[model samples]
Target: ETVDGPPGARTYRRTLRLPYGIGIAAVDERPGTATGGRGARPGGWLDARLHLTDPRDLTTAVQRLRRLFDLDADPYAVDARLGADLRLAPLVAARPGLRSPGTADPEELAVRALVGRDRAALLVQRYGKALDAPCGTLTHLFPEPAVLAGAEPGGTLGALTAALADGTLRLDPGADRDAATAALRALPGLDDHTVAVIRTRALGDPDVAPPGTGAPDDWRPWRSYALRHLDVAGEPQPRLARAGR
Candidate 1:
């Protein structure tokens, strides 16, 4: 979908794997050619992806995405409750707003998160054009905190990046969700959004609040999964840009 708004109005799209007997729907502003834009480039954008088990639910999922961005929207009725497959990507091109990349390696998305806007520009600048030297780096989900911690200001990563890097402060695999949240909260510069990313990715809790917000109690243990449901069922979307990646 082509989402226009703010100075950074973004476009999103998704790649579909239409399998027989299964339903699938995806929307993107421009799934192709997004990666080739960013840093000194004016059209840099972030790409997000969501998949549903039912194909008839595409309209519902697209609506939630619109509402998440604060556009006046209404969605259809659908019941998609799978989360393990939702994929989100951001195209950090040097542009005013961002566009989504079709389907890319999770690692590239991870690097985009590690090196945010200001710093990502610097990284691109450091390469002295071509935005190369690390154009397509990929690694595991929930990247090493230290990797983000090492980012240079505005040029490497964004604010509160350090807290995300702290080993003790970050949530790792199989960690206690509550304790992880507390630790993240203790970090002086830890932003509400970063903390939420830690909660969901590190702990795999899915209970992490979007940005600084909290999830409904009834959605516990599968909040992330529930989010996909709402996203596909045309339910209200959460304000997540402020929370996690």
Candidate 2:
């Protein structure tokens, strides 16, 4: 969505998955000079502002944004540990600080995991709430679990939404990782692969091993990044990029 303004001042805007309440984040895409341009590589810049419904949501909002950008990770420590491994050393050398991308909304991600991209998009278009003011092509806040529960209440999507809406299964960052994984696995129709995706993306557990892939011991607490590095055959994607978001 583009916020209305003067030329060269257009801002891409969207509703966020805030803790206390729904919020809007407007991000300016224009590049800017860094603190030290000399010896600095070229990169894109974003000037972002968040408008929240409540003042108390600030802390959670900031944390979510950090997770969204994978900013809180200590890349030096992660690289030091993983770069020593024979399998990942060269990849780590090639890409100094790889990070695992996290999600802003866990429940939404869980639903998308089951329904696939096109169906998820259709679900958003069908049930999402329209913004008070539209922003270019972005106009809806992806439907919350409760909303989706009412929209679909019998199939796998319904079961997942019901679990999410009632808090029977918690996928938040603060949720207990092992317990949440178990609970998600116990849910009807949710397989190990789906649970693993939730653990990696939703819960932000960087060390989560894939369903059957064996990870080295040194990759602990950062195996998710290592898995991502392996997924690309040593060429990892940028940290800020979301996978098909």
Candidate 3:
């Protein structure tokens, strides 16, 4: 039951629940303060954001949030662990230098550079534009391989359809990222740009190799996402130091 409360700041959104259970809420609280400015906020069962301070903690947060939202009949300890595991801001402060910049239009760079303007334009118009809505921000959920694979010879959806028709661009979720990147690179008509797009955005791999490209220095785990940053920032994608490593 909510109908406006104290004459204070911040529009507190509260979800009532059993006393011992967690009552979900969010406030537009001021930085370092419990009070927040009064403003209407969207309400839902969940809210998420990348803190950008530490990668390991952020990854742990993702795992914990997953369990928190897991609706199985299992006991609530799963969610409690998430709460307990929530690392304080100070602890993360010491562990900075994580999560570099990210992508703008990885697809655009990949399509235009590798696939050529005409074909890339068609592919972007067909699948690239609508990818975000359906696939969300998750790179692994990019459009199907068949469509992209046949994007050239068949038009936009043509390559995709062809890939689907023939078994060349298998859309199996179980496909390995490295193998998928290799397979995408092997498919006909695909140049560096297009293959990189498939590997980084489609396959959710940051370490995809550009065709006939240069050295591959290690950026450790954030390779693909980091490449995405380079692509988005209009900077050249980083070269992999070791070939095929």
Candidate 4:
């Protein structure tokens, strides 16, 4: 349970990348109750307040939040598809409601792919935008591609930033996957693995099988979810064998 806002209440808060600017939102998780031998019913409503730098970005902010949390996914459908695979059936049974997590801003994910987490922290410390009203540890908005582009965030980073800043590269959730993959491949210093990762996490492509697993054709359109289940079940994922460990 979360520990902010009020006693006996759990609140989750985070910074979001809106179209015009950045935003911070706080949402409370209301408890669920079982209805007399029936399943539990969600109690609280999805009430969230977004504090944005620009008031006009409300719509964009909401859209970004939905993408960030992957609220659009149909868990039942995904589980059913992956559960059809014999090897994955058992794992799917073990975890009936697994959902793939996605990022709000594709550009930020691309930058993250280029610079590892440690370096990302350092970059944030040095260059990220400070929120007007800081919420606990939510001190800053991630550095934007334009901001990083101006700072010359190294070679591969530089190319990525330039592309992102100028719109040469698009990572929006609705962006064409094939085109995005091809564009990423054209950039210097990017490998197929990195591109695949971007496809999975940033774009929220549910069917991304890591390069060279020869994942069967049947797993199409939901392989990313399968990969997550395999990882959780300690099954061998040969495509990302070393990294998965």
Q: Pick the candidate with the highest lDDT.
A: 4
Q: Candidate 2: where is the Cα deviation over 4 Å? A: 1-13, 17-21, 26-47, 51-56, 233-245
Q: Which candidate is the best by TM-score?
A: 4
- Please identify which of the two predictions, 1 or 2, would achieve the higher TM-score against the true structure: 2
Whole-model Cα lDDT of every candidate shown, in order: 0.39, 0.77, 0.39, 0.79
| lDDT, model 4, position 117 | 88
For candidate 2, give the lDDT: 0.77
Selected candidate, larger TM-score, 1 vs 3: 3
Between prediction 2 and prediction 4, which has the larger lDDT? 4
lDDT of 1 by residue, 78-196 (tens): 11222222321111111212211111212222334444656544543443222112212311122233444554444323333454455454333345668767865664555666555
Candidate 3 residue lDDT tens string, 1-245: 12233443343332212113222223332223234456644332334443322343544434333322331212233222222322212222322222222122233333444545576445545664232222122212223344565554555434534654576554333457666556556656665666665555444443544565442344334344334334444667444466474
The C-alpha stretches of model 3 lying farther than 4 A from their native spots are 1-160, 209-216, 231-245
TM-score per prediction, in order, is 0.36, 0.79, 0.37, 0.82
Q: Is candidate 1 or candidate 2 better by lDDT?
A: 2
In candidate 4, stretches whose alpha carbon ends up further than 4 angstroms from where it belongs are 1-12, 27-49, 53-55, 239-245
